[model samples]
Target: MITLLLMMGTVSLSVAQVSESTLIRCASTEQDSLRISKNPALFKLRQQSEAVIQQYISRSRVNKRTNADEIVTIPVVVHVIHSEEGRSMGGAGNANITDAQVNSQIEVLNEDYSNTSGYKGFYTDSLGVDTGIRFKLVTIVRTYNSKSQFSPITDGDDLAEISPAWSTNRYLNIWVCRLNDRYLGTSQFPVVTEINNRTQGLATSEDEEQDALTDGVIIDFRYFGRNAEAITSRIYNLGRTTTHEVGHWLGLIHIWGDRNCGTDHCEDTPPAYTKNETTDIECTPVFSDCRGVNTRNMIENYMDYSPDACMSVFTNDQMERMHAVLELSPRRAKLVEFSKITTDELLVDIYPNPVQETLFSSIFTPNFEVFTVSVFNQRGQKVIQDKLNRTSLNVKNLPSGLYFYKVETASKTLTRKFYVR
Candidate 1:
């Protein structure tokens, strides 16, 4: 057991595995501890990152800077590391899951994050809400390896090194492979202090390079997609494992804080205890001791260790926390800046492909008068719809992400893509 005195308190992390189909849920906490042990500077970096995140949240709340309606899209790259047996499909133990499984997991992420109605991730709880965050699968790379399973604790860096990442700052890289029976997945938490240091002239070349290499989420192949055929445990075949790990990638800790009756820092998330290595998959209400009072655990929360079927929501505060990370965190913030739309269409010229303050739209040839501009996020949600009486539009409030803008006149309509940084 490795004990570390975190800002919350002294947390002990045990690194061991009993089986692959039960008990152990995720080894993110243990993997984090291991990383910190290898690089002691990470301890201070995480502390600083948390402090900055808290401050950002506080200020945003006070100033009402929350982009509650803006949808931030993230580009994803899935690296499938598997053995020769993985090449075959339609089996209970196949490591290289099919493309359908990979796509199913993507659908699950969108459904859960947006809380699509009638989906498994939808809940009736008042605290549950649509996070307005979506993910786009940019690429999938399958590599055949001799190793059948990788250790979540020790082989994380090795796995990442083998397949490597697709520009960590631009994409959310997920490595899916066979993991030791103990863990379903692990995620590398984002460190913002190192990025902040770049502007403050406190970061070194070594810090930046290291962050680029080991900054992403990792998932066991079996627990990767929705009802993945290879997953032996029906309890976790719903693809929530990937959702849970992605939550960590977006700067969320376990609901229980990886300790007994601990705090996850989100005000809307009630205090709870760890559910690791437990067979309690029931959706029945569970309680934990918080300070002196008995508090009901939010087993339905994605950050909790509840089985895939039982977990369904992300609280409002949790949404804000994730959005804050997307807006301020280093690589996380950049993921939203990539636009899939092509820029070759000829109609009007949009100045400043990446506009931070104002976006100016100049028509090459004015075929008609009285034009209007409409901006839609990557999720096709129209965030800005207004008449373009003037050529310039104020986009200072749009959260950092890729967006499509449409300028419609009396006779013609033009659509193009733009970015907000």
Candidate 2:
């Protein structure tokens, strides 16, 4: 049973009934509705974002810009919120989880997004597509809080006040704590206007700052980390809970569409009514639906409300939608851009590594007016030079061999090696 928390001019938030309850897998959709109620403009911004995504999808068919080979790394900031008793890391049943446990969760995220084999996240299903996205742990902040547990609906603002997010536009801030035991996790959807320079310039400063205190993902500490059976539930210890919540963070809806026989906006995934039909705890394959027609429920999809062990894939269309969000959504796009430029090395991901005719680059730097790309042969002789007004560079003239490229920006210059085939 779900209880609603009422607040002035805010949407009601549903809280879990009791401790150790696994009925609620995620609260993102609920949180999103609440956010919309608080700020009606957010809904309009999301619709605008959807329009941009549709345009991106139409263009990607010809350019293949969202290719899986071009990886986008998002920097992560983990805030460990623990009780006074759970002050130290790595004790039996400690809320301040160990570094090893944290790193294990990161490993699971990379494996699941990359579709790495020999892991619980890997699947043999043809619908499964590599997302070409990666997460890097930049910093972990541990705070000792007096509260023993947090409620995703009511206590979210309190938690944020205790340990605030690091620039939401740049880093993916994740809070790990002992939740009310009903939910595994929750996340905030990306807001396009807050990140997009064009729309942001037109909006008031107050409106732009509306969501600053409430961006990123929240996870129950017990359900986090891989092989955490010693402290977590046997049904959810494999670290797939984080995977499912992160899918919501990336703009993918529940595979069941959060309604009766509704659509998840992806045609590849079969229609499912599990969102309203019932909470799914079984791994067995079954045919079910809302209307008279029946279709196999996609229990294997990461966005579904299934047991951790049963979830695996994100379909091709889902992959496209996520990639589009990363590209068109300014906050997400800038997160990738910030990751590339903020480091000491001024890192950039250029692909295909062994280029054929065209070479692509990640958003190299933000606010840099002009930059130059220079290429040299194996003998260190300059072969190609051009001003990079966009993310792609033409290497069709270069012969099939190893080459090196240097990107010069106003702030710094970075050189990396690549190949032409």
Model number with the top lDDT = 1
Q: What is the C-alpha lDDT profile of model 1 across 211-293, one tens digit per residue?
A: 45667888887778876567667678788889999999998989887788777889888887666344556666777887897
Worst window of 10 by summed lDDT in candidate 1: 7-16
Query: For residue 353, what is the lDDT in candidate 1?
Result: 69
Q: What is the lDDT of residue 281 in candidate 1?
A: 61
Q: Which pairs in model 2 have colliding backbones?
A: none
TM for every model, in the order presented, reads: 0.73, 0.72
Per-residue error for 64 in candidate 2, Å, reads: 3.8
Global CA lDDT computed for model 1: 0.71
Supply candidate 1's per-residue lDDT for 266: 94
